[model samples]
Target chain A: MSGTDDNAIVAARNFVASLPHCRALGMVVEAAGDGVATLSMPYSEALIGDPGTGVIHGGAISALMDTSGGVAVLSHSTGAAMTATMDLRIDYMRAAEPGGRITARAHCRHVTRSVAFVRAEAFDEMPGSGPVAVANGAFALERATDP
Target chain B: MKRPEPIQVVKQRRDAALRALMNGVPYIRFLGIAFDRRGDELTGVLHYDEKLIGNPGLPALHGGATAAFLEVTATMTLCWATLWDDLEAGRIDVATLSASQPTRLPKTIDFTVDYLRSGLPRDAYARARVNRSGRRYASVHVEGWQDNRDRLFAQATGHFLMPPRA
Candidate 1:
């Protein structure tokens, strides 16, 4: 697929917009370029599990990585890709600040007949110094056949 | 505004949903996932408490628990989608399992996690999204954020294969 395929990016954005939680969290695709896609999700209080003390849950971060990496592959594949995370390892760099926007940039490093590899990084744009999280992902793409 | 209902009632409903969602998973019960039914969407939350601390030094939440939360959220989304009368619920039963069926059962083939932000003392919030294509399988995106700060603490994306039940 061409890097400037507006149709593919629009389809991906539409799919994400249809999700309730993604809407609640304010997730949006900022841009798509050359085999790379950038997504942003805002923080919401309803997303917090512990109200007393502020702590962003780990599960939320995983979602961002998945979306970023999946979209990265989708940009290059002709058919839809079904990502099966073979393995995932995370290193906590630091705690996120309250009410900050987390932005992720994902790039496809390699793609073969069935497997695709991607790397992503997410960080707060308010300060935007060091990254809050970095991820490397592998996904399997299933080519769709014409009926 | 007044609190909705008794916490017990809410807890019971969440437990039932979790049990129906997956089989042979003991940690879902142990973690105490609470479900909120809003129209068609089923929202589940794993409340943070003192017991959630896995390591003393960094006090990171257990990775397994985080993974379970992601898997369950995806399963719940597929389950909720099954309620539509026009859709075949049975296919979904297999699909949901396939969506999360790890390449290696009870073992992670590959996992990449990022810590976007950290929480202060206790508690965090996690949100997940599951995307399914036709009836084959699904992909889930989960994010964990420190409760107070809107910044994400960790994020993960997972893929599961759904094959017809044998």
Candidate 2:
């Protein structure tokens, strides 16, 4: 990508980071390049649906997948766009325990005129292992119009 | 062994069962899935808390989370309606359903949510209009309402492929 394209991608990431929920979720853009972005969300007690058992909610995991996937496409397109999830399927390979940070690596597999396909995986960092939940997502992006 | 109950008997009972058959999902219970039920037309609310927030500027519910909820909701509706009786009976798992499916289930799917209007800062209300075709496939129009006002947070339509009974 040209320097201009790279700068546009950075600007897009900054814009998404400015969203309120992104900040609340503690989402960070770890890396962005080649139409892919890796985002991370720190595990917190607030994410615990079952306090006693300390199990992370599926909703929380899904949230991470959606944001990371959306941002990945946004960074790739380098345009102001609103994302709508056409379909998302999540397979819970294993339980995501509370207090364990989950990171999502999202990549834009394909981008059509109006639709973008993305896949992401959420993993907890342990001694030496990979992610837990693998999520596949598709997002439809419409060019944003400024008022 | 005692004679098994008639299929009709099981179907009748299923119509009134509220609990999700899938077990060990902590968040499903936390979200109060017990209060919800599936019908010819399934309607339910997806409760959201602070944890759902992803971006501070939007403070909006994450889109992928919304999609997963919709897929599960639609799947449960089909299960509750006993639409997949053949699959449940171990007749066929992939054939019959795949032939006549409504929503397409890619390994991964995308959802488009439009924030029609913003609602209360905390909770959002969502509903789905489910439609099924003669034991084949099902389609749903789901909407999320938030901020007292009816802002369309997310809308989804999904298809599940059921295998045929042997």
Candidate 3:
């Protein structure tokens, strides 16, 4: 509920919006600032994996966590406006509930000279059930002054 | 129902079998992913679409799309092995397979993806190698490339829990 106070948040918001895959998956930035970013994707029939159960696909959640982690890394105050995922590891804890909005929250755990570490989780807006998936990632940070 | 040479039958309907496999998962279809089959090998194709671009400034494909494509390749390769074996054993046919309810798909226990380069704005292809496959477990490594096969943009290793065999 706060306006952009820094270039990092603005860049992260623009990055998320301009991403075609984010639009394709209906990802929205719920909150972003201070080395943390949260995104939500509304459920749709097009995202279903099993037509029988109408559960969202694991691959879609994979996309969500990856982007969320990337956003968190980019939003950090590390003087890096651009970041590329070096590697990401995702574990599926459970299938996302059908017809439920899925939210992915990511925190930048640390930043090295050239890499940022991120951890992300996806929740399907269902109480009691834990995260649908969790992701650990490392991203290559590129500052404007990087040689 | 009619008997035919196993090799000949599998060769005759390999594409149909692949199509049937894709039909099993709605997400694969939603992503517009298709398969290219040669004997037992499969190459997953993600054709160029404006919706797949993650970095519009660079005009690059989304990392999530790339990951999904690789993951689908990994799991489908494992699933295809089963379908191939079943076909060779004369346990299934194209018609029955296609008409049957969507079969089970492997469940991903964990997956790790390495993005080596930005995915260019074009069609990308991936092929998965099953590192290990048992009755209940499978491990696969998949690589995605565009324009040139030697220059890979992304690769993934995944462990999947195989669905119980019917």
Candidate 4:
């Protein structure tokens, strides 16, 4: 990796560190590269949807995907600025297993002057069965003027 | 649990039921969302907490929080409507229903959310409309607003699985 790529990764890390909800949800930044980002959410009792099944709630998966999408925007941008989710469509493929960390990987597929599009997937264990959920999202970017 | 009482008394019962919903759902209750009941209409309110901030630089509420709020609002609205339907039929009492009731939670099958604006640091309100409900599934539209209802911060549509009645 070049110095420029290194700086962008650091910037992305800083931006992720500043998200209060990410910390509250116990989400961590695993890796970030050009137009790509990965995030993980640890298992928590607070995220359980069914007591009998011990399955994680679908809402928790939605949160993970949305946050991963936002992080992808940071990875793709030259300078991190304010970006908010414009829209997101999530499809639940299967119920996430309890007591396993959920990992979300997002790719910033496209970015224009005002909007960035992201595609993401979440899974408990990758290279295993398949994704638990898939998402497509658009985010609005508020870019800072270059000096 | 089917009993007909005064309208005011019934309203109180329904309100208590809604309150119990807010307290029972581990996730919705975790976010501290409360319901405001007006006759047959219900609105969900999510009070701003420091923990809800997603972007410290923007000081905005998390997008996930907004989505979750809207989703919860949609399900709660459906459950509320079911309670009224049961009450009108005089078959089930709304006041007697608990969170553990089978029909209390509507499992989300699909969800789509559109965020029109940043979720600024403030109390957010959401209202849901049951677009179509059948025996096994229900579709709902939910809108979230902060300062102005006309200018919504986000809108969502979802399909939920409806369990068979007991």
Best by DockQ: 3
TM-score of every candidate: 0.47, 0.55, 0.93, 0.89
lDDT of 1 by residue, B1-166 (tens): 9667677765554444444443333334445565555545565567775444332334445443455465555545554454333222223343343344421121122234443433333555566666543455556666665564357656666554443433
Ranking of all predicted structures according to TM-score, beginning with the best and ending with the worst: 3, 4, 2, 1
**What tens digits encode model 3's per-residue C-alpha lDDT throughout A1-147?**
355545656677777888888988989987777779999999988877766678888889988998998888777778676788889999999888898899999999999989999999999988988899999999898889877
DockQ order of candidates, best first?
3, 4, 2, 1
Off by over 4 Å in 4: A2-9, A77-80, B1-4, B88-90, B93-96, B99-104
- lDDT tens digits, residue span A14-59, model 2: 8656765567667777766666777888877655543335656556
Model 2 residue B9 lDDT? 62
lDDT of 3 by residue, B30-134 (tens): 788999988788999998899988888888888888888999899889889867878767688778777857767888999999999999998999999999999
Q: Which of the two candidates, 1 or 3, achieves a greater TM-score against the reference?
A: 3
Judged by DockQ cut-offs, is candidate 4 incorrect, acceptable, medium or high? Answer: medium
Positional deviation of residue B49's Cα in model 4 after best superposition, in angstroms: 0.5
Candidate 2, B1-166: lDDT as tens digits: 9788787765554433333232334444444332243424455556665544444445555564455455455545555455445434655334333333322211112223333333334555556555653445445456665554344655655544443422
| Selected candidate, larger DockQ, 3 vs 4 | 3
lDDT tens per residue, model 1, A18-103: 54434544679886655678888877664443232343544565566656676777777445444444445544355567677778
The TM-score obtained by model 3 is 0.93
In Å, residue A32's CA in model 3 sits off its true spot by 0.5
Docking class of 3: medium
Candidate 2 stretches with Cα past 4 Å from truth are A1-13, A50-52, A77-80, A144-147, B1-61, B64-166
Runs of candidate 3 with Cα error greater than 4 angstroms are A1-11, B1-9
User: Compared with the true structure, what per-residue lDDT tens digits does model 4 show for residues A1-147?
Assistant: 778677766776787778888788888888777878889999988876655466777877888899888888877855447678889998877778788999999999888888898999999964677999899998888778734
